[model samples]
Target: MAIKFKSLPRKNPQDLVAPEKFYASAVGDGEVTMDSLAEMISYQCTVTEADCYAVLISLEKNIVSELAQGRIVKLGRLGNFQIGISSDGMITPEEVNASSITKTRINFRPGKKLRLLLNDLSFKKVG
Candidate 1:
């Protein structure tokens, strides 16, 4: 299936007076719920839907636990999940500490399999 996208007009940040340009923006079709994912996985494997769901829940909990310990969680073909932080700048190196941290975010770097999937995607322009 092709990914759907629509043209969106956006003004240049550097030259606002210039004519706006249209860019392709991906439109989401819909969301797949956890239950739907479990069912799909069950169909593809020998596991039951309940077992798949239980494993998915455990995976979620364990990923959180591992990340909380300041370690990167690597899921083979899926990729790696790590904590990233943005911080306020300090004049002196010695002055910089935990208090300088402004925000923390989870970062996901897709693995080779996902990257290959992106390369193979077909896009369709929508209204």
Candidate 2:
């Protein structure tokens, strides 16, 4: 199977006066929910679907807990999850504090397995 994409018109950020160019944007087919994932995992292993789901839930909770503690969570061969923040600039270092933070988000860095998968992916253009 190939990843599907569609051409989208986008203007150049550096030159607003420039004509818009078409770029390939990925089109998602669908999403796999936690329940579906657990069922699929159960089929691949000896564990029951309920047990797989419970473990997945616990994994989600623990990942969040670790990030809350200002630590990176690493899932072997999966990737790393880290907390990222954007803050208002202050003239002096002393002026900066938690209140300066304007945004917080979780960042994911794919591991080698994902990277390799990316290297081998084929794309199909769709209308």
Candidate 3:
């Protein structure tokens, strides 16, 4: 008699999810487009490539301090937006200084549905 073993299933690297398709299909009776993103990116009265890069950079920075320097506005999903740090206690001198020194710290938070869609990392078999 020979011993037998069962091999685990192999995952195909080619099988990947389409973010654009997922975003479009799940926009809840709406469409997704480069224009839409461009509109969102133009929240600060401008839509240059530099502005876009600035926004992304601010998002990953010291958020608390960034807002204190001035208004840290971010364009969000569905044409919505968010302003950082309204109340006190969440602020420190360093944060304040950081905020003041940094220019245009934009932070965009995806909508609940968009977040859900992004969070969905389910894998499927290819072909």
Per-candidate clash tally: 0, 0, 4
Estimate, for each residue in 97-121, the C-alpha lDDT of model 3 and write its tens digit.
4435434334566767767875665
Clashing pairs in model 2, backbone N/Cα/C closer than 3 A: none
**TM-score for candidate 1, residues paired by index:** 0.83
lDDT of 3 at 124: 35
* 1 against 3, candidate with superior TM-score: 1
Measured by lDDT, the strongest candidate is: 2
Candidate 3 residues lying further than 4 Å off, grouped into runs, are: 1-46, 64-111, 115-123
The TM-score of predicted model 3 comes to 0.24
Candidate 2: residue 3 lDDT (0-100): 99
Ranking of all candidate structures by their TM-score, best first: 2, 1, 3
Candidate-wise lDDT, in order: 0.97, 0.97, 0.49
Clashes (candidate 3)? 4
TM-score top scorer: 2
**How displaced is residue 32 in candidate 1, in Å?**
1.3
The stretch of ten residues in a row with the least summed lDDT in candidate 1 is 111-120
Q: How well does candidate 2 score on lDDT at residue 105?
A: 99
lDDT for residue 25 in candidate 3, whole number 0-100 = 20
CA error at residue 30 for candidate 2, angstroms: 1.4
* Residue-level lDDT tens digits of model 2 in 11-101: 9999999999999999998999999999999999999999999999999999999999999999988999999999999999999999999
